[model samples]
Target: MQLPDKKFVPVMITPFNLKAKVDLDAVSRLVDFYLAAGVKGFFANCLSSEMYSISEDERLDLTRHIVRYVKGRAPIVATGSFGLTIEDKADFTQRIYDTGIDAVILITGHYANVDDDDDVLMRNFDRMLKLTGDIPLGLYECPAPYKRILSAPVFEKLVATNRFVYHKDTSIELEQVKAKLAIAKNDPNLEFYDAHTPNAMHSLQMGARGMSSISGNFYPEILVWMCNNASNPDKQEEVKWLQAELSAVDPAIHVAYPMSAKYFLRKRGLPVRTISRAHALELTPQQKQTLDEIYDRFTGWCDKLDITPVNVEELMKPLIHLDPPI
Candidate 1:
């Protein structure tokens, strides 16, 4: 399957009602929200989705739900290989890939020992590839549980495979970003989505594909706007302004991830609840006040640029049929 060409693919959050079960209805609404916001594609079951905390059954069900709800509107990719052993992880990957996602994103270096060499990680990856067959693959330098930013040689080895096409380069260093983009250029099929928002403009200016981060969950239209216009010479000033605006969101919200994201979504009028079984971060009064202040700042920035903010109710109206439980 071909990777998504458009920029601003957001790593999606799995919404839950008060009970904290997989809220299928909220999932439908969230999918519609992302699509309406002009996201080029969807990363459904990634770290942002709380993959490490979700049950295997929930993962499968959620992936299938997202695939069906999206209905080919965009390319969907998921991370499902969370099992303890390589064989188990591959088995899970096969199951998630079967749910019609365009690609299965493997968490790079997830199975390696402490300070392990690249050879060990690559061998583990090779075993995963063998078990999953010809499924299109992507790589994520996911920082949770452990963060193994791929070494240049290791990443070069990964790119040599040719099958590992899409990469979520979470590294913040501009030099590292350049190196990965160089590797991406080597293969026509390879694409790198930068997950670090602080350097998104710099990375995009240097040929990185787009932005993928929890911050996108807050101001996706801002991301979409920046991605679409960053390359235009005339828009450099606006891009710089937007980059500064976008960079502030990560620091303000990282204090409480999916929880802050859910609260922001609710503020924007989506019917999602601020409930997270994964992180369970409580929103203190002080944090809530700070978030409100941030939201005001965000809207002011949007107003200045004429960027459209998505209407949650309008987006959800068409998804009424999906209100029933699966």
Candidate 2:
């Protein structure tokens, strides 16, 4: 896919309703929430959005809605993957050219992962990037660490291309994360990000440009504020709050994200759903109940922290009514 020129504060979205529909209003609310809370922008249909389950039409509609809402207030780095063949992925890549978006975050899924020789995939990536028009790209490195971690050498080769651009380094290992950061330090043009929230301080210390994560989706101000003040004398106090917020929910993650997220926000009157219908990963009744209960306390924290609640529609307004970054 094409690469992005600017580095962004990207939040992964969650719009799963009961009918498995893409609620544009909820999406807008999320945009509004982040923009007001000081986020640069978002990556809709990303890992947090459960991209594997949504359809092409849905992705397009969502992007259009987001572009309309953002109205150039912030940059939007969308997703473009889900190809059966090289041409198929390329077709998807070219489709984004018309969407008024800045870049596409390319994930390494939907292709057959053959034994060690990933040359075929890389070649396909080259093709996809060429066909993706002139848009910049954001390489999504959220490889479940155990599943598709690319060698640092392979990563080096990819960034060799001037268009390889920015990267989101989500390899769970600290060394691998540090290796990517080290490489980025040498390449002044490359923008590197970390998604390992638990180790945010260590990451910033090691030279990650910033962080993009689901935790940011829940608490964007905290994440960005912490990064913006990583050098402050009160850094330890800031991290203490981040760690406490991070540990609020179960760390098993994957299946629990949407409900927990919506529950917490809804308790704050954000108007999101309390379930998931896309992936259809059914949570046990007891699990759902536990999520609701944790979110109950989450609401209390939000109240104490003075964080205002806003739904997706109200969040990402297409028009910049207030001061437009003069």
Candidate 3:
């Protein structure tokens, strides 16, 4: 599927009620929040969504729910590389694909073990491609299990297959991003997205399709602004300033993970509880304080940049779904 230029696809977080069950109501509101903030797509059931903590049934249920809620307003993608073997993974891939998602994302670490060489990974990936029968696919260098970064050569080979349409690159180094972008340019179908928030400006400037970073979970509109203005000649000064601000708070937001994100979103007045199956411990006083400070910074940036943050109140009003201009 073709995505618009400079899109900010949030790595969605799973909202759980007090009993730790998936709150479908809250999830619909979250989708509204993301769309209202100008997100182009959804990465449901991803690492940020605590994918490993939830059951297989929950994965399918949640992805299906998001697809239904989105109502074709935006394209959705979900992780499908769950089983122990390539054959099993391919089976699950098709199962998730049947949920009406645009593409099934394969975790790079799933096809091969942490110690496996690139050759072994390639063989397994080739086997998976053969078994899956022309299903559209994407690559995610997910940090879980292990981060098996794809080499430039391997990336080029995969691009040649003409199957991958999305790539979430976690190679934070700019040089590696540049190398991959060079190869990605040769294939018009593959849209490259960087998962690193700090690299947003540089990556977009270097021709990445957009960003799919965890930072969007906390403040999506800011990320959306970055995507829209990162490559503009007139926004360089503001872009550099905002990039520094995001880089400064990146580590702070990761202190408690999805819990931190949930808390931040609640602070923004969404119905999200600070409950996360991935993070068991409650946010410490200190952790909460840090997030509060980051929230202040977010407001300050919004004010300085003249970006109107999504109105949670207005978004909570009666839902009138309209397809995005994209």
Candidate 4:
């Protein structure tokens, strides 16, 4: 359950072919891309991957492919909270864990309805823990279904279980983030990751293990740099500057996302098609223009920071044919 310090785990986006099927080849390339960008781990089959859009068998297949393709280069975790009941969720948890993932992540919304109190949520979580045995687990406050932001009390209670090891916090509010971190900051067994890009610097300073924001999907290298230097005394000025730059465009990258991310990566020369099952509509010219501008800014950041962005062309060299046609 222990990951490296200041890790940048990307909430992976699924790559689909023209027919909207999972493109395993593109997936392999994407893994290479993330690893080259210095990501410490991968959060596969999560919201960015369009978990709700893909079929149950596809989920297992996709996650299995990532686990096999990664080949233990970095730890991998995926969502396991699906189905109508806790028992059903527990069943899938075991199934996905069998796929060789380091841990099974449970969506907070799956445990209780939007209106349900924390007590109800805790009861279901306790039930899930009991049903699933000692399999490592994580929590994600997924926006879909309804984001169930855990209260500080609830988070402390869950941390006490010692069954949970990873937490992806989407509270967004710094106060709430600080409160939760106060409880988890001391737990070596738990690694807290902030999902809000704007809160990245503060959260990391306040003791977040690393970041797993959607921003990583666009420019993982920037996020990786931030994680590596967020708290360094010598880097505070640069960190402050980079934090402002990232916060300024946080909303821009989120517009038409997963698609925006695919478009951005395509601009970086990846083979990912701008096809997303979650977002069926195509990006408008305006959206594309905005992302293009962001792409320029991303390059400028890399130059100013002396971070050499990953060369997608070189990264894909092994996949290309170099022999001249006869």
Candidate 5:
């Protein structure tokens, strides 16, 4: 597979289903939707998609289906997360790499207290690198409960190995972004992407490179445009204006990220649907209102980009019933 262009805005997909099943139709429609929206690529099984909740067969099934659906229109990256064994990571990655994906995102596997000892972390990283060979892998730097934050020195050492090329920093804190920026700025091959849209501009200005975020999953056009303007001093105000639109939505309403995103996509003239997997977080009345407010703001911001958001009821129908029964 060819290399993914640096300017591409990869939307982290959040698969959803009202019945708590993987909505495969919605997934294909979404792939087409983002491609039309001018997205450079897509990342499946990432946080926005709730990776750990889905089974391995589901992951591979999604990847294979999408690879055939996408047909190389844009690079599709499979997220490397099993939350299990290192061998599991290698085996899964090798299998996915065989599926013709351009790259695989290697996040820290399911382990705890690994961060305390840099040796253990490096051992894992090096082990992955050796197994991957020249498959073109990246790192999803998510410092969550299940995964350890690769320290600066440890990260630098891993990147220096040249096995990994892209770094998606999902660590939400700005200081962490800054710290990663400080380290990533020197590595020329490392393509640093800030998953935190709140600090996207600062990261771009700091010479840290581009972004790939969950928020981008909805507004692929705006996200790609923002990256294009990262180096342009004239577009600073424009980028700031767009980023503000994303901020108006409540960040906590992740229960239905796909629901929220597809709501807007259907509005934008796409055939995509909203679906979620089993074990998804259930939202309350206030949460529903919060999501409503987010789409409200999203529609408002749509005007700024000339995208007229879809009607709420139309999308709400599909959100409530992902697949029209077997």
Candidate 6:
């Protein structure tokens, strides 16, 4: 499976039913929606997918299901390990690879108790790689439970091994991003994906490979459009405005977390329920009002990009329900 080009790769959410079970039906619809929207690829079983809340077996099953569902139309990268032990993590990673995903993403702090020590972390990483035997890997600087930002030297060291192919950079610091890009420049295998939407345009300008922001869950095509047009001298002004629009997404939708995202997806007509086991379902009236404004603004921006959102009826027509005998 080839990796997706430098474009919008969404860290996709697992759509659950009202009962909070893994809804394959919803998953099918979402895949179609993403494909229709021109997402370059998918990042599955990440924090947005509630990987921490899900059991190992469930994560494996879901990863396999999505791989099968996509049928290789786009490359797939998945969060492969969250195990406390190196052996366990390697085992899980091997299992995830067996499912035929293109690459595996590892949280930076997974095997370490202390984030300050680089040697310990690198040693643990090397040990895990030894067991997994040359499967491609990506790093996610996910800031949940805790954040372990990779230092420049350690990052260079890891990339030197050539096993690290993709990086989900969440440093949120432009200087650091620049430094990382410099390190990445010499290595063809290394590509950095900026997770910070506010810094996306600048990062792209600085030679980052692509985007892996939460906003892709809602407006992947817009992100794709921005990335494609960001370098055009004539499109500078238009791209600047869209950058602000993209940056505003985190504040509005991230406020409600995975819940707000699910709600927004439902609004876009994907068959997803707002049920998240990782977060509370409660949204205050004021929050709902804020969400409403965000939705309206989002729709306006979509129009500005000349992107039409898919409706539920359109997506569900192929499988329209049959009448139940009562």
Q: Which residue pairs clash within candidate 6? A: none
For residues 1-326, could you state the per-residue lDDT of candidate 2 as single tens digits? 32122222765566655576876777777777777767766676676775666778877777778888899998677777656776776677667636887777777544436354678657767777677666677677554222456568877777776665567777878899888777777777667777767766667667777777766656566566656655455456755665566555536333466655655555444546655654445556776576566555545555755555444445434533331221
lDDT of 5 by residue, 1-326 (tens): 33223454565564555556677777776766566656766776666665666777777787888888889887777776464677777888888777778888887644235445777777777776677678888887664445566666776787778776678876677777778778776777777887777766667766655777776665666666666665567666777887776655536434456556555454454444444452344445675566666656666666765664334344344544433421
Question: What is the per-residue lDDT of model 6 for residues 1-326, given as tens digits with 9 covering 90 to 100?
Answer: 33224677898898876677898877888888888877878899899999988899989999999999999999899988667688888989989989989999989878566545777888988898888888999998888767788888888988898898899999999999899899988898877899988988898888988888988887777788777777768778888999988786677778878888787776666667777888876767787677777778878987886767655567677764432211
Which scores higher on lDDT, 5 or 6? 6
Q: Which stretch of 10 consecutive residues in model 2 shows the poorest summed lDDT?
A: 317-326
Candidate 1: lDDT of 6? 47
When 3 and 4 are scored with TM-score, the better candidate is: 4
lDDT of 3 by residue, 111-161 (tens): 888888999999999999999997899999999999989999999999999
Task: Give the TM-score of each candidate.
Answer: 0.94, 0.80, 0.96, 0.96, 0.80, 0.93
Clashing pairs in 1: none
lDDT of 1 by residue, 182-264 (tens): 87878888778999888888878888778887788888888888778777787889889888877766687888888888888
Candidate 4 per-residue lDDT, tens place, 1-326, comes to 33237999999999998899998889999999999999999999999999999999999999999999999999999999998999999999999999999999999999999999888999999999999999999999999999999999899999999998999999999999999999997678898999999999999999999999999999999999999999888889999999999999999999999999999988888888888999989999999999989999999999999999999889988886232221
Backbone clash tally (model 3): 0
What does candidate 1 score on TM? 0.94
Better of 3 and 6 by TM-score: 3
The local distance difference test score of each candidate is: 0.82, 0.64, 0.93, 0.93, 0.65, 0.82
User: Which runs in model 2 stand beyond 4 Å of their true positions?
Assistant: 1-10, 16-18, 110-114, 142-146, 244-255, 281-326
Sorted by TM-score, highest first, which candidate order results?
Answer: 4, 3, 1, 6, 5, 2
